[model samples]
Target: MRTPLDSPFSPGSDTVPQVWAGRTAQLSDWRDVVRPRRLAGLPERGRTILGEAGLGKSSLVRKIAADAARRGDWVTPQLRIPSGTDPLKRVAVALLDVARQAHLATSREKRIGTLLDRVEAVAAAGVSLTLREQQGPEPYSTLTELLVEIGRAAIRRGDVMVLIHIDEVQNIASEDALSQLLVALGDALTHEEDVEVPGGMLIARTLPLAVYLTGLPEFADMAGARKGATFARRFRTTTLGPLGDDDLASALQPFLVEGWEISDDREGATRVFMEPEARAAIVDLSRGEPFLFQLAGEQAWYAGTGDVITRDQVIRGWGGVRSEAAAHVERILARLPSREREFLEEMAGLEPADRTLTTIARKMGLRRGSDAGPTSQRLDSVRGIITRGKPYAFRHRAVEAYLTTYWPDPPAGDAERESTSAEGIG
Candidate 1:
């Protein structure tokens, strides 16, 4: 049922791959922490996953949601704040989604269903509410009260918990709205107070809810700038970086086995699709970036004719891979400010392995020592472009390649002559 043209590598979709590679430890840590009974004594801090665009943050979120959903101890709806959406409205809808999925008795479902209907009516009338329960046909009052109701329903069903996932969180857009969301989440984890009912009876509820958010690294900076210090401190941050060479090799192994045909000749059988040299070529082409790994493999698979993928096929595929990578790299570069683009172009002129902040400052004709630090910080804010460190290098080779290929000739001045001493990126 397998064809030579069918590629195991998928690009552009953030869904998890067949053989997930290099993230077992992170997945395990979160699974244990989010368990129903184990959530006690656990800090109610948010888990914010920070990474570059294609470094698998969304895929990791999907994997975690899959695991939690399968466990049946939690109701995890994979959600994101859609662009131009009211964050509060989207939050209410997300809660309603989880509410619909929750296992509840008939009486509880009717009550929660009525609450959802009222919340939807308020949204249709274009209004927001504070966290409080409403009487009759009025709105639910606030996100806090709606969240409390959802959590209470889940708790009454047994000790079930709710886990919410929001990706591309930077699009939430309003600081006030994001703060309100945080307050709701904070209250859910720690709130234990009695509330009065119409019949003079009182009820208290404490719901177990866990939240996770994923976005680019600059999102951290954005959160700090737009939302202030308290907003930034609400979440615990975890960063995702490119894999090492060894891990990249391990990730590629499953793809190779699944794609190729194994011959029953030697003790372990011979591979018909991948030669050792070809495998090395794919790994080298990827350069430890997950997206590039899929891109290179996909291009090479399409180039080959028969079941076997040889070194020459990989060579031919590089043309397609380079073309695709160049387009992607150019789009990323086009988003940068003019000065940041100039900084990267200058960095491209030096030997990528030896270039440092000091060398760059001198090459760019900086007059004062104080100027280099701010320039470096500015470029570092552009995620996946230039990493900030001593002897710095571009995070991806494709970025350096695009800059070297498209940059205009150096100006006829001291900077031009000094830059030519080293080889430029290709």
Candidate 2:
């Protein structure tokens, strides 16, 4: 057999994972919430998926979108709210794409032809329209109108839904823009409520538009801060943490058994990817983070030769895993203010087990006042890098190991320093 080379694990840089494990409950729950018709007495609230970096927020959204599209119940156009971009204009263009797709999907007569024509006219005007120059039938209004029209068409033709999947929603810098978007969605639903078709045609009483957004915890907080709690309350927020041990194992199993099948002497040809010891070590190294699982798996896959991957190969692969994860650490640390970086470096010196804020404060030689509370908050602002629990620790073991290289030398009597002097990846 070939090296069983093609990877089934998706680092999610290019493709989604072939075998998605965990998140089944979340998928089902959200699907029902956003399903075509509004449930009796259940409001159509916006859905927000929140998590730290590398927790597969975007991947989960993509999976949901793909499933919805496959059923022909929804037309999902994925959009990203990139930093500093005009979210309104971006949404406008994205809705236009949705309209085009709807146009292609339905026949000429039943199609929302009038709305599609208006969308084209607005889009042809270019995305450079100023707020003052384009006040009447504005971008927000146009989008809402288009969505309601689409919903009306869907109701006429079975029970289709239109869901827009937006990622990195935290990057939308304008709080006003976020508020406007929620309003647009609200307006879309309201408009669909009283539409009476000219030719005695009937439309669904509920709007079929749903917006799903995903971003880091900090961004979610920022959005909430920008808009008041009432505005934030409009979204049904779901926070996802790292996977559990069983779920992590389930996620990795497919990659091994299917992607890297091995030949066993006793069993002829069996699909066992890693030795038991190797699997245990990789799981430990992963520390429940999804991206780390992919990174470690990618390294271990190429580290071994022939059928089974041994514990030794996994151990060796860990060296490369640590290095790659450290690069990520370096990038995150670079973005931190100097004070936060200093706080992390100080935290790194203590034995990994003794990294609580109380202990960390003592080590920094603080008397009455300590920067622990604020500094720890700053560190966690990077999201998922530092786990701010009872005993503070790097979210991943590999991150802790990488930080060991940067620990400052100990004074003669100090007990915290554990690593030799070296230029840490500053």
Candidate 3:
């Protein structure tokens, strides 16, 4: 008999799960679109992944970076968006750190040495500028210089690719900083130069850098609104959400396909399989949201009794973690703007089959459904908090359940209101 496996699910923020699923379009875009464009020296291209928190935006980007690393690309550490004056200093540090690990020929070593000095100088300048004292060269200027040079050297080598993955892009505070970094990236990407190759002088793209960015849709929308369409249109935008039923099942059954690894140091942490009934039960409990899916999977593993997970075990596991799942949903709600939450509350107050824009408007005491159109659209597009339909729906059933539990029930209809007023004191 085989031992039961440890919890292979990742329930935390930005952590990649053992079983990957439902990202065929995104994964293909990275490989087919970005990878091919980069290799062919076509126009600059990459992906900007925008979604609500816990939709695995960061995790998706990390997965891409990991794939690049496996393909022997020169990859940088995951850099979070910078705050202010020390903008992109993290970029320098991450790039240089990875580059330092390379063992190259003497000439290439000297070239890398020069790049390292520029990176250090850029980092120092940013630090100095942060302290309100400019000692070295300007941070933004030198940052641009260093990144371009790094990209150029990589292209000259003609061996490996360079990938920079950024997380928490919503935290970017400085417009000037963002604009400057974009400028540097644009310059590097569009650079055309004749370099000495093994055979002869041939025109080549100077820098072959690919970027993958992850952040909240709210921030992406706000930045684009503030900084113009360039910020939004810089990359192929992908909006993420919870996995669908089929995809969720795929996520649960990763090991069945072979070559998938689950590494854990715990006793009885080898392998396990779920009955279809059990997998469906877990999926229903998850409400198609990833955080809950992961949380439930994690708890299911802990509460699991045998090598084969049964529906009863899935139920027992979820029973242990339902409260935690509710709290997670509440946190998601608490983070939303007041209007968005109010909209959700209005929707939740109604029956699931009656959750239309008009019903939501009525619950919110608005005169016409059109009055709520913009807000509804914002909620749907910005973070996918609510989806649109004849009878609208939330991104997850758990969210609707959470809202209904706390918010007041829908108010009396027009007929009820008229009936009550007419009969008063009569």
Task: For candidate 2, give the lDDT of residue 60.
Answer: 83
Q: Deviation in angstroms for 403 in model 3?
A: 3.8
Superposed on all Cα atoms, model 1 deviates from the true structure by an RMSD in Å of 8.6
Kindly indicate the candidate among 1 and 3 with the higher lDDT. Answer: 3
Q: What would the per-residue lDDT of candidate 3 be over residues 319-421, giving only the tens digit for each residue?
A: 6676787777778888888877888998887888999999899888899999999889988877777899878988755676567653111122423543454
Q: What is the lDDT of every predicted structure here? A: 0.62, 0.64, 0.68
- Candidate 1: list runs displaced more than 4 Å: 4-6, 32-38, 73-77, 108-114, 122-141, 152-161, 189-207, 255-273, 352-354, 378-385, 400-426
Return the TM-score for candidate 1, rounded to 2 decimals: 0.75
Instruction: State the lDDT at 305 in candidate 1.
Output: 51
Greater TM-score among 1 and 3 belongs to 3
Local error of candidate 2 at 223, Å?
1.7
RMSD of 3: 9.5
Taking all chains together, the TM-score of candidate 2 against the true structure is 0.75
Candidate 2: pairs in clash = none
Tell me the lDDT of model 3 at 105. Answer: 20
